[model samples]
Target: MNPFSVFLRARYGKCFASREAIARHQQQAFAHLRRHIMPRSPFYKDFADQPYENWPMMNKALMMEHFTDINTAGITKEDALDIALTSEEKRDFAPMIGQVAVGLSTGTSGQRGLFASNKRERALWAALMLGRFSPSFLRSQRVCLFLRANNMLYERLGNALISFEFYDLLQAFDLHLPRLNKQNPTVLIAPAQILRLLAHAQNDGAIDIQPRCIISVAEVLSPEDEVAITDVFGVEVDQVYQCTEGVLGMTCRAGSLHLNEAYVHIERDIIDEASGAFAPIITDLTRETQPVLKYRLDDILIPDDEPCPCGCASLRLKRIEGRCDDILYWQKHDGGLQMIPSDLIRQAVATSQCEIRDYRAVQVGQHLLKIWLDTDDFALACQYVEQNLLMEAAKLNTQLPELNFHQGITSHLDQKRRRVIAK
Candidate 1:
């Protein structure tokens, strides 16, 4: 597929009129994949004719284990991982394996997976991102991205018309403020936490940047933080929910998060039946280098059954909740474990009437919860947060965990901000 073809395919190529139309389009995409893409992979060639259900389920561990065979580029896992690691260590992403660019997946702390994208794939990604999410096509805009690391795929977006700059998150957060104030990017992209930091800086008059578009990536942007950032910077925060797998989804013009069903087909792996919460198993139709077929991401997504006002037929989401591994549970009266969505805990602190600068909820034990809040009057904030959490627990009809409150937020700027974690 050509670079411009991705734009054509995403923007105007296919707009399903109904869910059934989406099904038919996905059917054709899978057919094309089975006929052309699957035959190229040694790992999948034998299973090309098998039923969809018969295809193996993939995850980070399995992908890494079968990397060499799974990729069409004929590169081994060791070589790819080595190249990716070296690039990250040196903070230089210029090295390439032939025409293919290799990068590492930054997930929850263990067994970081390797991802490969050929030159064509990189161009397509750039086109899709620019075509779909760019703030304006008519003006010469500067797009600034704050990321843990940079890759060739991200670099592809920089050209004569657009000035694209990547700020390494590995550097101290304070170091970027001066440069950002001077750049005054037209489009600002960063993880939700970094955006929150920037919002605070802007509020304090430390940095003055009025980005026309603010895009949150890499981390889940909670409703409170979104509001905080939007209140500080006058633009609604658009979210791009993506990972190493591919660009799974992004916010539409109506501010609803829609799965990128035009190119990526996602299967729901239900987690909470009552809430209709499920994890995403995605298959990217355009990824020929390293096929992402039936790849299950760890994130929990809450669906919105209502159609978006933007008239896009893609699946809508209420929120991209935290990872499955971080799902907090409470012991039930009937000896069962009941799931308490991390969002509820987030709300317990965020929705409190008192001002809360930041917080983290960690389930350290079966019945022990530790919370740290960064705000004026720490004791008062803790009391309010505890009461709210207990009220929620009572409403849910579950045993309340012991609330342990600390003085301030205990997290680093460089790490992906996870407000709620289960130990």
Candidate 2:
């Protein structure tokens, strides 16, 4: 299929007019993909006789274990990893196996993931990205993407109208400042941390780029980071919820992130019904080479109770909470463990009286909490944060754990920064 045709279809075509329409589209796409992959992919051979919905959910461990057999392309896990790692080490993204683009995940979740996309997949990705990310295709656009790894999939986004540039996150920030000022890209995309850094540079007059749009990708955009970036750019910081699996969602004009229901079918694994929080079991119906059917993700997402004003009928997300493993557990008087939501921890820190520049809270043990903060008055900031957390815990009728304060918390570009973590 011509990529431009796909782009046009996604942009102007009424692919998702209603909930029923989207459901029908998903059914058709899933059926088509299953038919194409069942015969070629050995990992899915046994599932040929099973109903699509009845198939067992696949996780990262299973995918890694069966990587060679799972992929329709005859690429081994060893070879793919070598290719992806070589590109990262050399700081070159030109290498490819045939027309397949190979890249590695940041390994933030402990195990690095390898993803492969053939030429067609690359085109589809670029087209869909442009269709969603661009405000208007009629006008020319320049995009500067700050990411740890680059691949042909991103490079394919470049065209006459849309120019694409990849700014390696591993490179020094000082090196990026001059290039960013020169590029003055209309669209700036980066992780929340990088966006925060750029926001500081913009505030300090070190970088001058008035991007029409700023997108947060890869990392969870905390409330603090979002406000800082938005304040600096004078634009609502939008987000793209994508992973190695596929492009899952894009923020609409109303600034609400909606899942691309046209491409993927999401099955919510509800954890908290009251908050509409769930881990997504996604099946990317359009993916053929490496079929992602009934794949479970670790990240937790809260659904928006109110309908989006943008009127996109797709499923909307209120917030992307951190990983399921990071959800803290607190012991109650009844000896039952009560769940401490990531949002609650975030709120406690965010609403603290002292101005906190940066912070991280990690449950080091069952009854131990390690708090790191970067602020002007370390002692006062620590006291305020500890008190706020204690108050929050009291509301839940749980005793606050032993709190340890650290002077500063540093973040690295190669890893996803989680404000709240559980060890």
Candidate 3:
């Protein structure tokens, strides 16, 4: 075995052995972050004087603004971007020892951000995910990875039983489908939207191949999307909340999505007046090349206040609420703040008996709500939804905001569409 591989096995095995042991390991990890990466990086050095417990929270905007100065070992934002972009073009660049891998995201909030991971960091991620999520699969499984770009770090997954074929989403399906269908992969992983499309193709008798497992990544999977995809594919859908930032969480065998305890520590605080769902403030213990210490994320995560039935004792995320930008804001007549909850909007619409396939809500002002409903029974559906909203608002002792209903299909920039927009 390779030296790096051996090191990975040893470190991750110890970390995943038990939750208590992993906490002990994190103490050492935090020490390493303080001693080595922080002092070397100019941005982290500003926080150097602050106690680790008192480090200031950060977000995408802050990271992008001070990108050059925050990276450890004198790594610059330019270098990180160069590696990420060049690697996307298939250039091979070896990351320094203890230097984490950097990946950039096409940010939904208008600007892109960087995600860093070292060798040991990636190993811990793999261990935490595979060890708990897909224990039945191994290096012997044939894996098909569908993504926009496949990087060198992802290339490491190839082994005797674990051969991977990267299928780029941008390419024409006709060019790759025949070859892939012949290979007959044992595991298929793709974005939830793409997986649904694949399921449709199979149902239409376009493709015939069964995989042992299926993983959904990149986009959020609506309950409807999840049910349809799983039903047509005939397998339970596994979700990985991953992006250019980091592998945030993965669905375990027991179906509960668990956070990776070894790499990241997440805290939640309420940012808006709406659902009161806690927004994520992240502390990445594994990032070294560019340390993401106390970074705040815009993507709102649903917290599982209750313990999981799964035996593994790890941080549990209940569900991911849509992004902060997706939250609609309303102006009250009394000049007080009264923002409508996205969850309430979703619940109100979802409960309608009408088959409203898709919809988007735009806030015209603080008191006016412009709703777009995509269904044949637009009038009936709108009436049903408004009644629900009125009932919910009454329960909270708040007036039902005026609703202006429109009938049309909303065009999306990315493959996935946001159900609500803060206009």
Candidate 4:
């Protein structure tokens, strides 16, 4: 192991790993964030003058509206997107912009955000990931990292024992499924949606290969999806909840989501059950290029109350709820908007013991609700759900709206299957 990685392992694992350690690390990391980026970065400097206690929170809309002023010191949003989108053609995509790497998201919520990382930042991420997910892989194991676009940070993991291969899911599954199965990858990291499809393929006798373990990323791994993926792969289906916003948290070996306490600080907004859903207020402590200080995220995160089996002291995140965009809009008696938590609805439906493997709720009109499930028992299950929803909706003080239950709601082109859809 390198000297820096050893130091990081001790500093992050031994020293700043528990709740007490996390507090101390955050204080030091926040101090360094202010000291290092505040002076040179214009985006951070503008907000640096604000009181630390009362620092303004930012969101994606604000970042998009003020793209130029909010970006990192030497990069622009347009330049970063152009470079990221064009990176597919380059052999060394990450080094195209020197030691810095630019990445863009699919922007499922309308506008994509830009993420930049220098060599040191990339190494820190790599080390943390390696330490948590595959300590064995670092010595000798083949790792397959599935991504939409290739970058140096992702590609640099290629080694003799740890042979890294990046495959784009955009390609035909038939083409790559065989290749991936042939490679016999030791560690398979991918989005949960893709994993679920692969699981389905295996059940249907299309693909016949097993991975040691599966690490899910990008989207929320639903309870049903988790079961299917885990069963098909014959391994534990863990999740890593991260994005362009920041490396918010990752699932530990014990199957609990532990925030990356050494690199980021988080403050969450808890929505009253009577209101709708809680959103996250994020602060990226390690972002030097485009410092995201007190940025609000659209995605939802559950509270950490259950004590984890894992001994890590970092704050726990139970589950990443749906995004703000996924919230269903409804009319109140006062003629205003009231939102419904899609995650809550999914939980209600999943708890029914109705054999509902997959489902989607689509709002056709103010008074219409379409519920689609992937089971033969959906009709009988929906009958019970219809009554349960009426009682549940009454608690929320909204009409149950017409309920139409259907079977087999096909997956979208993006491969994302939404449980609730509001028009």
lDDT winner: 1
Residue 251, model 1: lDDT of: 88
- Candidate 3's TM-score reads 0.81
Ordering by lDDT: 1, 2, 4, 3
lDDT of 1 at 248: 87
lDDT of 4 by residue, 1-423 (tens): 232663366335553335777788688778777776776666667556566767766887776555566655577667777787777545335634556787756556657666677766666666666666663633576677776555666777555766777777656666777777777777788878788877887788877766776888887788778888887778988777777766678877678877766677877677545442468788887677667878888877666766677677777776776776666766666666567667657876777767877778888768888888777786688876787777777776677678888878676534444567676
**Count of clashing pairs, candidate 3:** 9
**Tens digits of per-residue lDDT for model 3, 145-209:** 77755554565756665676777665665566777787777778787767877787778877887
Model 2 regions more than 4 Å off: 13-18
Q: Which residue pairs in model 2 clash with each other?
A: none
How high is the CA lDDT of each candidate model?
Answer: 0.87, 0.83, 0.69, 0.70
CA RMSD (A), model 2: 1.9
Q: Per-residue lDDT for 126-157 in model 2, tens only?
A: 78877766766788999999987788878865
Specify the highest-TM-score model's number.
1
Each prediction's number of clashing residue pairs: 0, 0, 9, 0
What is the alpha-carbon lDDT of model 3 when measured against the actual structure?
A: 0.69
Candidate 1 lDDT: 0.87
Better of 2 and 4 by lDDT: 2
Determine which window of 10 residues in candidate 4 has minimal summed lDDT: 1-10
lDDT of 1 by residue, 70-158 (tens): 99889998899889999898989765899889998677655588889988888887778777767777888889999877898888557
The local lDDT score (0 to 100) that residue 269 gets in candidate 3 is 74
Candidate ordering by TM-score (highest first): 1, 2, 4, 3
